[model samples]
Target chain A: MVANIRDKAAIVGVANTAFSKDSGVSELSLAVQAIKGACDDAGIHPREIDGFATFTLDTNDEIEVARALGCGDLTFWGRSHYGGGAATGSLHQAVMAVATGMAECVAVFRALNGRSGHRYSQGVSGELLTADAIHWGWYTPYGLLTPASWTAMITQRWMHRTGVTKEAMFEVARCTREYAVSNPNAFFHGQPLDRDTYFNARMIADPLQLFDCCQESDGGSAIIVTTPQRARDLKQPVVTVKGVAQASAQGQEQMTSFYRDEISDVSEHRIAAGDCYEMSGLRPSDIDAAVIYDAFTPNVLLQLEAWDFCKFGEAGDFVLDGNLRPDGRLPTNTHGGQLSEAYIHGVNGLVEATRLVRGQSVNQPGKQVDHALVTSGVGIPTGGAILGKLD
Target chain B: MTPEEQKAFEDRIYAYVGVKVCERTAAKDAVNPAMIRHWAEAMGDTNPAYTDETWAANSRRGKTIAPPAMMYAWNQEGFTVTRGRASDPQTDMVELFNEYGFTGVLGTNVTQEYFKEVSPGDTLYLEMEIDSISERKATARGIGYFFETLATFSDQNGEKVGTQRFRVLKFIPQEQPTAATGDDKLEVPTRIPSPRGHDNGWWWQAVDEGKLLIQRCKRCQVLRHPPRPMCGECQSLEWDSIESGMEGEVISYTCLRHPAIPGYPKDPVCAVIKLAEGTNLVANIVGCDYDDVFIGMKLKGRIEQVDEKTTLPQFYPA
Candidate 1:
């Protein structure tokens, strides 16, 4: 079931720490600072916030956040799993809590020390030694253990099935960095990448160059959600929650979905996109702009195909044609995404969605953004949310 | 070292490559709740679902679920020396190289991947197989021998669960003189005793009685080594201690020229002996040279009483 928060709840405030390779602060401190900045941006007191939502991987506890912010009481607290997939889901939970009278005001936050702390790019190891960990035993024995290696398997299969070239994948990375160059807050801001640079980048996993993967950054971002009436009375114009949905396909494994019927097609994205579109009462053509999760460049194309934004295997051509550019139809990741911006588990994607609705984005698209779609992590049980201007 | 010794060393080196020993128990049902809780605490996951049963009932997945990463938390149980006793190194390769005398070994990289969900109540059957063995010329860490081993785990129904590929590097001691391999002869004793017993103040009393015993479920007739309370096959609590013949045939064997485990003698010969009663046991094959321990070799079990409290089961050619 989908809960429509259109004109009922809105994101009135948003704030984030500086995105960088290393932010010399604890994750908790970053979270608290982001929360305080968001609250201040909305001109609301901390005592008014009654709900909190964040990622399960986030180190900041709800109670601790409340204590740090001097919040009076919390009526709703929630956490979403599946890494970057929970970015929009956290907002969805906050919006639901505010709309249903579960909480008067809800705050959604994500704090991560991605680079200097635990780097997922280092590959999956330690604490993964159980019976289930043995499944990768077959693949790792042949030297395929990293996340890029896992995704490379699917990318290779996708390439073999479709005549998509490495040039097509590079185009996606190029477009993302292009947007990043214009985003002042982006870690790679002012730095643009080209096809040659993308191809020449170090090979992290086979077929996946270093630039194809997202940059690990230490940062925190927070968004405040309140009822439309309350949001209208606050500092910013009410940006309605059009629709949100989370989906997990059958035969799903955590990171390795190799046993699925089709590895190239992300079934979770297809299912989530269907639900998000149906709930929003909109189609792919209706989305003026989007923030497609870019944990990996290939996943961006996969999301486009799965959501029917482009036909199957047609995303390579669509992306190459500058369809995802700010001037093109359906501008995506206007804030550089996880690839160019600091990846805070897709939280910054949601922030970009809010910016698109508020018309405050650095890489603002030409057309009026009536609807902005945002997606969560791609490989696992992903999530999606749509934001629209209040009627 | 004579030419025969060098030939024996080469033979041992070849046999150690891609060798594996299987643990009889299944993966799914072998989960220990206490162990899962401990790992969850270590990971700093305070989700009540892993601890509180009431909270778990309301969880999205319904039942209490172990954290996704908790499935890889099984302590490595090494090869069994006797019916109920096993041998494991006191320290890991990294720890031994870091603190102890093996100084040359450095630049260690470990990579692991996950395949399936290791839920609670799943019995885990583990099989450790040596994937490859390669020797590199003297690096900064003396002469290094790289051994890659893959451990495959399966559930009770024999469904493949996960796999672990471990790369171990053993640095040769600088002062240790290169020993002749062929001169190392396998020693076998005449009489073998059964290593088994119930906890009656002393755990391994049956080994002193000169009989090998295994706990058998009377209802299902399932014989279980490393005895537990109930029969994993039928979940029958009614069990009787049964004595089996010490003689068995080797299903697979490996002669180790490099010490994978620290403090153990270098080039020790290990074999997975399939007992006549249809159970496989892993132990050192004694009383035969490294060249003689081949697949399907017949061997008889002998009890080597280590001290007043412990007895090790050693096997030799029958």
Candidate 2:
């Protein structure tokens, strides 16, 4: 029996810090500030939040967060693996906790001093000795250390099979950067990347130029999830969680999946997309806007195909046809994405999802966004969420 | 000296090519977590893996390892070496360049190859070899010898851990322009082996003595450009070293432009030459016109001084 908690749990408030290269503060401070801002937006006292959700890789702990917020005894706390793939999983945990009567109010957040602190852009530099490091040792010896290098291998094969050029990547950057110009919170605001400038950027790893990779940023963002009854009692409008899902394929290995027969198979995202549609009882056409996880732009196009937004080899055409624009059939990432705004993992997208549903986004499209689909990064063990406006 | 006479003088010095000028040296202390902490503090990197104990214990990396960029720190000799050997080749070369009015010196580029992570308590030692020296070249910075030095790092167990190829320019501060080289002259650069571990360092040692050495597995008789400790087919560590006639042919080549490696040509020709010994090795395609670099071109390998400490095996069109 499907003990569905559809629309029972909703995100009543969303808040984000100014995204930038250096936050000049600790990650704990950023998290606490964002959570406080979210509680204020929801018109709820800090003591009311009884649960918290964050990434497993986050530097902050729930106990510290609760202590900082002066919240009562926690009723629920959870985390998920995979970088941005865990963004929607956080909301999934929050919604479950609220729907099951385990917690009355939950704060789902992601915080990082990614640029001012330990930059993930450096790739695997001997963090510690682990089984994963042992596997990477086989290739890292040959200078294949960065994420761009690992992604390049998959990109080369994909380009050979399907005719996707570097232009497809620039299109995503161009769209997001163009939108970011108006978004005050976006790091790339007012610095729209032109075609010539995009092409002129150095190629860090082959097929993936400097513009193709996402910006490493420092910021915090939080969504306050609560029971629909309690959320309706609050002053702000409610953006209810319609459906969310997480999935991983059989031959999943964190980021490097070249060992499998189909190296470029992004089936895990397909599974999550199917689950989201099934749980929400909605089709792709019902999704008015999309907040996709774009750590690298090529993966963005790949996820579009995996989620069935476009045909297998037609993602390039879909992007080139101005389908991702604000007035297109499905206006996507109007708040810009990781490639332009900031990489707060997936919380920035979730924050944008809430805004699109509430009709408060900085770059809100002319069309009504009754439903927004937010996705995590496309690697295995990924997740997604479908948030709907509660009339 | 006129540009032509300077060229002939450089040719005369090239005959003294295969000189093992510097001996092997070891660092003062082994790697430690304290060094990692000090480095992280200076750089303001509060990565818990480098400092916090509780996090590293639960993290994927079981214990803390030294930063990859800290490879050179393991065996860094202080400002003045306590065990500085007399008759240092680098000093002699610097003195020679100073005599020739080429006094300016600057570090250009560094390429490092790490085979394994270095952990606390693991001691490392590096033996450096001067890989190559450029003919007199003019740069905006000055005119100088672009010295390329290759250092082979090994653990206390004698396992080859990594290698660092560092290039430096010892040039003279000149205002006037100097005439360029011959049309067939390959851009002068520092040439070092892409990979040379303990088993193959002796081949480079032989090359420094003006001998083009090849490694042959005694068990399998298969030859390899990089003289590995073991044979690919037979898995035997024992091998025989033989001197080649330094003759080869270019099998493939590429012209690099961006991510410019300093001291080398802005547009350099990198060639993979198959020796007469049936082994293939990568070397700078020097002494040829940039457009004229082609596959299957007959070539010969020669020894050239890279720095005061090391010599490298280079190939030119035969």
The candidate maximizing DockQ is: 2
TM-score: which candidate is best?
2
DockQ comparisons of all candidates to the true complex: 0.02, 0.03
lDDT of 2 at A61: 96
Candidate 1 segments exceeding 4 Å error:
A1-3, A129-143, B1-318
- Model 1 Cα lDDT, one tens digit per residue, B1-318: 376864665465556565444445543336756767887789888888776667777877565666645544564443442455433221233343344334444323333445665556767677776676564434333565565666776667777776666555655645533452356532221112222234221224565566667678899897765455777779988878777688897654444332122222223455546678765554666666766665667899987753323455578899
Categorize the docking of model 2: incorrect
The Cα error of candidate 2 at residue B262, in Å, is 16
Worst 10 contiguous positions by lDDT, candidate 2 chain A: A134-143
The CA lDDT at A136 in model 2 is 49
DockQ of 1: 0.02
Could you give the interface RMSD of candidate 2 in angstroms?
8.4
Name the lDDT value of residue B195 in candidate 1: 24
Supply candidate 2's per-residue lDDT for A341: 91
Q: How many backbone clashes are present in model 2? A: 13
